[model samples]
Target chain A: MYDLRELTEAVRTFNRDRDWEQFHDAKSLLLALVGEVGEVAELLQWQPAATVREDVKAGRLHTRLAEELADVLLYLVMLADETGVDLGPAAAVKLAATAQRYPASKFRGQAPERQ
Target chain B: MYDLRELTEAVRTFNRDRDWEQFHDAKSLLLALVGEVGEVAELLQWQPAATVREDVKAGRLHTRLAEELADVLLYLVMLADETGVDLGPAAAVKLAATAQRYPASKFRGQAPERQ
Candidate 1:
């Protein structure tokens, strides 16, 4: 179990120790996050879903996937920090709101219709 | 502070209860993550970085930004879970490796040169 706050503080300390915060404005962080996400997409692209899942399960792509996903996550956490958003609470609230919007009794086994 | 484990459990339960896991193959989840990231990029696109910082600080864009960012996060967490990557440790290791890659003694306040 990892606390998001702990990770955030680690990220904060990492930046502060290096004086790298100056380079991490919201826009740059967002772009970095997007680039990392694109890498992740590229990795999984053109592969069948089952192949991707099986490879991941077998740990064949584990290290590379872990690295790319970590980049996406760290950049995201940094961006949220720069923008003054408490990501954990925001995510919890969003999940609650989504639950309200799509009650299981009705939406079970059904994808919501495209808007 | 929020535990990534708790969030992961909540997400798993949410999908299980809805029987939505069947629809969340690795490729579909990756696409969903990409789409949410696009939404985040759209929200910040074309804004001056300083202006974005000011708007976020003043809470003018807080709700929308939070919602969009939260979506990105949830989808990401779900995808990571699907792939069996334990995100917290991966991120920690990645950050540690990055610290080694760009030692503050040499790189302080300097962005790495573009490759």
Candidate 2:
């Protein structure tokens, strides 16, 4: 229901309303990302992959997963946005660079970290 | 080695080189996202989560994972960019929405899908 610009506006208003922007500088924001990720990881901590899969299916996992994931994405997008980065075309270039770095024959059926 | 704007420019050039912009409309771009995601999944197909962890550590997985993940992210960023979306402010907005939807009291020690 929320398109990107409107959504971004709301976030700005929220920050200004609470005067949270000063603290949301790059370092703090990045730290927040780590913190949120920790929270997300906590959901799967001490749990087997099977349980994690089940939890996802049952909608019984931590509430922060989406929140944290979104947080991470939001930060990344925001950082890029603030820096005048255009995501769409930037990605296309990354893909090209990645293609050169990791070819399909080497990549096929490979895990993310492997390549 | 790449900042966001330069990366985006490279991507745009890559597309223009192939005259691919016309096909990069919202619909096609979205479909491309699906395809990239599928490639990422293929790395884990029939494999245990343990294997995924190992692959990530040892760098034994498909090359496409980063490529695809970046692709999905790229499309999202581009879509937002073209539409005049600012990542940082927009994300702040989403965080606010999410914070309201799921409070810390409800979020602690939970996996992503639940709550």
Candidates' lDDT values, in order? 0.87, 0.47
lDDT of 1 by residue, B1-115 (tens): 2788888899999899999999888889888888888887887887788788888777658778888888888988899999998989999999999999999899888887756
TM-score of chain B of 1: 0.93
Tens-digit per-residue lDDT, A7-114, candidate 1: 999999999988989889888998889889888878888777767788776755778888999988899899999988888899899999999999999999998775
Best by TM-score: 1
Give the true-contact fraction for every prediction, in order. Answer: 0.74, 0.11
Please identify model 1 stretches exceeding 4 Å from their true place.
none
Query: What does the lDDT read for residue A98 in candidate 2?
Result: 61
Q: Deviation in angstroms for A28 in model 2? A: 27
Give lDDT tens digits, candidate 2, residues A38-89.
5544644555533444453345443334444456566544433332344444
